[model samples]
Target: MIYLTTFLFMLLAYLFGGLNGAILLCRLKGWPDPRTRGSKNPGTTNILRFHHAQAASAVLIFDLLKGTLPVYLAYFFDYSPVEIGFIGIATCLGHIYPPYFQFKGGKAVATGLGTLLPLGMDMTGLLILTWLFTVAVSGYASLAAIVTALAAPFFVEQIKPEYTTPVIMLSILIVLRHISNIHRLLTGKEKKIVNWKQ
Candidate 1:
């Protein structure tokens, strides 16, 4: 019964995570569909490019919340580490492949942060710091994402071994989703988030 309950919770979490918060925000603000502009992604980065920073920040926060809420609920229910891990990973996956977006969605960076933050603040801090440092130094979102994704599992294992597998799996998905960005970065064509104006 516990396993059944966990499965149901994970399913609900996925459904919740699958909401394209940026797209919804865009629609509400009467902005163009985010997926049709700025690298054709419904992520906070793209939203920032086409919309106001405040709107983009709101989307980012909500996207993170979507991933955080499920794992938090699992924890609140006193679910085991493994169950919490499952919920966290499912939430990230749902953000990447949101049903509301026809299984098309963002790169899941912010959502990944959400999922990781509840599991281990140290791990989350390391990932965020790494991403920020990389982005600040190189001005490449893809590079920062790739490096942080590679580093996140290591941090998780070191700080929270019980969640090693789930964190590793989430890292792999993040890296995979960023593959195109990696290619573009390599080819010198990836967009950089310089000034917010464009």
Candidate 2:
């Protein structure tokens, strides 16, 4: 029954992961599907960049919840660190390649953050700060995500040693999802967010 439960959780997590808020919201608001807009990503940053903040807010909440729920479920069920980690992976992948959206999904940053939020506030807080600070200084959401993901394994390991490997796996997945952005950043061709009010 252990294997069955694990399979079920991961399966449900993957399927739930398939539901993306960006695409759904666009359809409802009659806006162009986010996939066709700036960055062509279904992540919040893309939505906020091309669309208004209200639309992006809805997407962010949904994406964050989707990421948070699965890992929270695994944790609630007393799954081992490794099992939780795998569930986290499934959730992120589902976001990256949601079946409902033709397997074309957003970068897994928010989803990954959602999965980790349940682990503990200490690590999660640090992670958020890192992302925020990076974005504030660099104006590059992709760069912020990459930096935070790379920092995740370290902070998580400090607080929960057993979660080190699994967290590292999650981190790797997040980084891989941002490969295109990384290439653009290196070539000086990436678009950076500018504060209009400034």
Candidate 3:
């Protein structure tokens, strides 16, 4: 019965994560599909880049919640760290390759961070700080995401060893989703967060 419940929660997380907020919100607002503009990615950065901040904020909140809500509920119900980690993994995977959107989805940085909230606020905060610090110093959002994703397992190992394996899994998935960005960075083709007058 417990296994069944966990499976159901994972499925729920996946379905929730699959709902691409940028796409749905843009469609509802009669704006161009985010997938058809900017980076051609249905994510907050893409929306904010080519569209309005309000829409981008909405997408950010939605993405965070879709991953957070399910995991938080599981945590509240006393689910094991491993179980919670699996749920988080499912949530991230759904965002990365949502079947509802033809299996193409966002990079899932926000979703991945959101999943960590149920583990510990310190863990999540540290990762967020890592991301922000990287972006501020380097101005490359993709680099920040990559750094944060890579740092997740380290943080988990220190704060919650039981979640190490699951966190590592999530980190790998997040990094894999950023492979294109990684390539661009290596080739000096990746775009920074905003234009600078350097």
Candidate 4:
């Protein structure tokens, strides 16, 4: 029974994760598919590039909720921390490669943050601060995301050791997803937040 319930939750979480808000709003407003515009990603950053801040904000909130709501349910149901980690990563993966979206989804930055904040507020706060600080100084959103994603496991290890192992596994996946950004940074062509203005 326990296994069955967990499996169902995982499935629901993945399908829900695939429902990208940016894609929906783009079509609603008659905007071109985000996948064919801007950075060509079905996430908030690309929406901001193709649309306006309001549209991007909506996408951000929606994506964040996709990660938050499902993982929170795992906690509310008293699942172990390890199980919660699995649920969180499931959502992230859904965002990265949602089927209905032709397997081209967002990079999962906002989704991953949404997934962890509720589970470990203090550690998540640190991660958020690190991201903001890095972006402010470096102006590279991808760099900030990479740094924080890499650091998440250590914070979990110290504060919630039981979650550490799975968190590390999830962190690896997130970092791996950022490989393109890493290469762009090395080539001095990575997009910065400031670039959004012009």
Candidate 5:
């Protein structure tokens, strides 16, 4: 029964993650599907690029909650840190490869950070600052994501060793999802930060 419950929670987490906020919100507003616009990535940045900041903020909050809910539930049920970590991973997988979206989904940046919120705010805050600093300095959101993914597991290892493996898995998954972005960066084709006024 314990195993069954755990599996069920993970499944729920994945389903929640599979709920693409950009896609859904765009649909709600009768706008173009985000997956078909801008960078063709259903994420906050893409929405902000083609749509408005208000829409982008909605997507960000929605994605963050999806990442936070499942893990928080697991923690509330007294699951171990390792179990919670796996649940977090499941949420990220859903975002990256959502079954509802025919296995095409966003890069899981907001959702991945959401999963960490239940574990410790300090780690999450550090990663957020890293992302902000990288984006501010480099003007490449994908670069910031890659750097954050690389840093996440290391931070977990130092503060919560039990969560390291799952965090590492999540990190690898995120980096892999950004492969095209990495290629763009190397080829000097990556999109830089867009001016909010323009």
Candidate 6:
């Protein structure tokens, strides 16, 4: 029944992750859907374009929470590292392609951050720092994501070897998802974050 249990847990994790707080908030506020706005992405960055920074921050935190809680639940259940990683990946996938959003959802950055929380604080911290550094230096979310994803395999392998395969697979998927963004970035046409204070 272990396989069955794992599948059930993954399904539940996906359901939780699919709760797109940004889209919900936009609908409640009668604001334009973020997917139809700047960048055409249903994520915090796009939300910031349509609403206050506070609103976008709220959505980001909520999305991160959705990604985090599931993996924690799997850990609580005393699952194997592979199982936990599977659940974590499932959560990211759900956030990236939420059923509630008709399978069009946010990029998996925040969700990936959430999934890494249970792996270990040090590893999670490293990933966060790397992502922040990339974003700060490049101001391109896609670049940050790609750089962070490329760093994931090394981080997981060095710190959590048991999860290496899963982490590597996740990194591949995240990198693939950002391929279009990479192309735009190369062409100097990638969407840049606007200074909202003005």
lDDT of each: 0.85, 0.88, 0.88, 0.83, 0.90, 0.85
The C-alpha stretches of model 4 lying farther than 4 A from their native spots are 195-198
The lDDT, on a scale of 0 to 1, for candidate 6 is 0.85
Candidate 2 lDDT over 60-90, as tens digits, reads 8898889999999889889999999899889
Per-residue CA lDDT of model 1 for 1-198, tens digit only, reads: 998999999899888988978989988878899888979989888888877889889998998888888988888989988889888888888888888878988888888888887866677778889989998888777788889989987887778898888888888999999889888987989988863445
Residue-by-residue lDDT tens digits, candidate 4, 29-148 = 888988887667788877877678999999989988889998899999998887788888888888888978887888888888888877567987888898888888888878888999
Which candidate number would show the highest lDDT if scored against the true structure? 5
C-alpha lDDT (0 to 100) for residue 173 of candidate 5: 90
Worst 10 residues of 1 by lDDT: 189-198
Which TM-score value belongs to model 3?
0.94
Better of 5 and 6 by lDDT: 5
Quality of model 3 by C-alpha lDDT: 0.88
Cα lDDT tens digits for candidate 6, 114-196? 78888888898999899888877777777888999999889988998998888887888788888889889889899766323
TM-score of model 2 vs. true structure: 0.95
Name the lDDT value of residue 28 in candidate 5: 90
Preferred candidate (lDDT higher): 1 or 5: 5
| Per-prediction TM-score | 0.94, 0.95, 0.94, 0.92, 0.95, 0.93
Q: Would you list the clashing residue pairs of candidate 3?
A: none
- Which residue pairs overlap in candidate 5's backbone? none
